[model samples]
Target: MESLIAAVREQDEAARFLVWPGDFDLDRGDHVEEVHLASGATLEGFAGDGAGGTYFFCGEGGEERPILYADSEGGAAPVAIGLPELLRLLLVVPWWRDCQAFTAEESRELAAEYLEDMPDLPARRDRAAAALGIDLPAQADVLARLREVAVRMGEDFVLVLTPEGHPYEPLFTN
Candidate 1:
């Protein structure tokens, strides 16, 4: 299969949509700080958000490797096990950063705000998903999976500040 990064580069609308609501840019893969995984696994900066946040592929592998998100604020979490899952989260819930609670009610409120800003979020997301050949799951499912991945599956994938030898704080609390 062709790499999702390659696909994103080739698909204009997919890349555009990801840039807008997703706040994701393939060109901004550079993380601002020096960091490493506690397990000493290979951490590759693959993508980034508008802020100085980085999306890293943990361990040695292709896009199938676990993904860790580290924000400039020094918080980190394992958002997804793979690139596909991470993209699904971005596509379904662009306001994921605002969703500290990660509840259906909170998501609904954030969705409403986003809808007000970009009423065509669903259509745009659908086109992006189609372009990327990704089958997006329901918003609830995506959020639930995010919670599980960041909260449950994240303990083993701790991000450490290489400079100070201190572990980054967990982004997701519940």
Candidate 2:
């Protein structure tokens, strides 16, 4: 997780857009640690938060971590895998879901472009969807909605989480 964070920090685009929670001293039992304790899932790192909830990347380590979204309701759902995949989804899914910015064909093309070089992307996507207890079709629907929400809110917008799973809106410029 530390390595991933470092890599992200080095990238101007990712660092600029993917807000990190470590910036604020929120008394929320440590976001990654708490989630690890609660679910027995090892925290690889955190992605960001949204109106939907706080999102995290968890796994033992390596190139395939499952992205999870946890909310104030004490519920968590796996959304995607790997930092790259999650970022791609964040960029394209919402636009696809809204159906206002891109057509289905365009959405697929965009997703493909963003997901280029990802080996076995379909399988990874399926694993994430299954972890969330969603079927294939439903998974697609959720991604669309998730994408819509994330993009409309702003690429850099992230809500910091309290130890109790409550979210605090953090001010983000650009």
Candidate 3:
């Protein structure tokens, strides 16, 4: 298991210390719904007319998925409607690191850094091709395929593609 997963599984103290500020609406976008906790505690997050806040969830891989939502009358701690809905909620949010999940702001920052560090998407693609010792044309083709994969599976899961239109298998044998 990845170290992050291990840390969460062990229930590290840091896990509890992390907090995402948001109004957790348990209603699944409904007008009237009841929200409670495992311990049956009545939970209210952000309350009042025209209030705004955020709620946080732990992702399947132990990453924090923080989401911000607002309601005219405020919100409450999100109740798990079901397994699938809970899973969907997990995908819509970003992976948290340390005390906070990557907010929309953070994603922009990271994307900017990545673009600045590379400065050339096509060149980076070419270099990736060269690192795999593939020809330029084949590399371009594979990159196109990867781009498609990135579009389709983005956030739902992580994917890596090869020049042959196959998923890139990490080098784990060495």
Candidate 4:
């Protein structure tokens, strides 16, 4: 994880793409509000997005732990089983946040918008992936796995507010 982060930080274009399209900023690991897991597992905030959304590594361990994404609006979801999987999602389908329906057509439509804005998205993503030593999956496959992680495996890892003791709503739905 440290090496991958260093590689990303070393590259200007890869860092820019991750910050813009991927919505991932390693420097912003702190969460705005107090949060925890309903299961009482350790939730470590390791990254954040532009909209105050945090990516937490669930449970104790290393970067191999499951990752849960919690939005400022009190919504959360298990986005990936590990850091590598999460990076693949970000590098392959940076438009995952815009994919509400989680379908191929929706991905294509959203991908078009990104491609129009950055024609070298694929090439840039490839370079980023290569730097991280990760082989990304297809867009549809990544999205599908994302949904599966968020909706299925996500059931066991729920996010909750610490002070209010209120649980966050699920970000993904069947």
Q: Return the top candidate by TM-score.
A: 1
User: Which of 3 and 4 is the better model by lDDT?
Assistant: 4
Winner on TM-score between 1 and 3 is 1
Residue 126 local lDDT, model 3: 43
Q: Please state the error at residue 38 of candidate 3 in Å.
A: 8.3
Q: Which ranges in model 4 have alpha carbons more than 4 Å from their true place?
A: 1-3
TM-scores, all candidates, are 0.98, 0.40, 0.17, 0.94
User: Each model's C-alpha lDDT?
Assistant: 0.92, 0.43, 0.29, 0.88
Clashes by residue pair, model 3: 22-53, 22-54, 22-55, 23-53, 23-54
For every candidate structure, what is the RMSD over all alpha carbons to the true structure, in angstroms? Answer: 0.8, 12.6, 18.3, 1.5
lDDT of 4 by residue, 1-174 (tens): 375667778887777778878999998899999988989999999889999999999998888899999988999999999888998899888888778888989999998998999998888888877767788788889989998898898779988888999989999877
Candidate 1 has its poorest 10 consecutive residues by lDDT at 96-105
Candidate 2 residue-wise lDDT at 103: 45
**Model 3 alpha-carbon miss at residue 56, Å:** 14
Which digits, one per residue and each the tens of the lDDT, describe model 3 over residues 129-155? 343233443322322333332333233
Assess the local accuracy of residue 39 in candidate 2 as a C-alpha lDDT between 0 and 100: 41
Question: What tens digits encode model 2's per-residue C-alpha lDDT throughout 1-174?
Answer: 455445544554434333321111111223443444244446544443433345655647664665555554444444455555555554335333223333456566655754675544555544443433334443355455444444443222233343565433322111
lDDT of 3 at 125: 39
Q: Judged by TM-score relative to the true structure, which candidate is superior, 1 or 2? A: 1
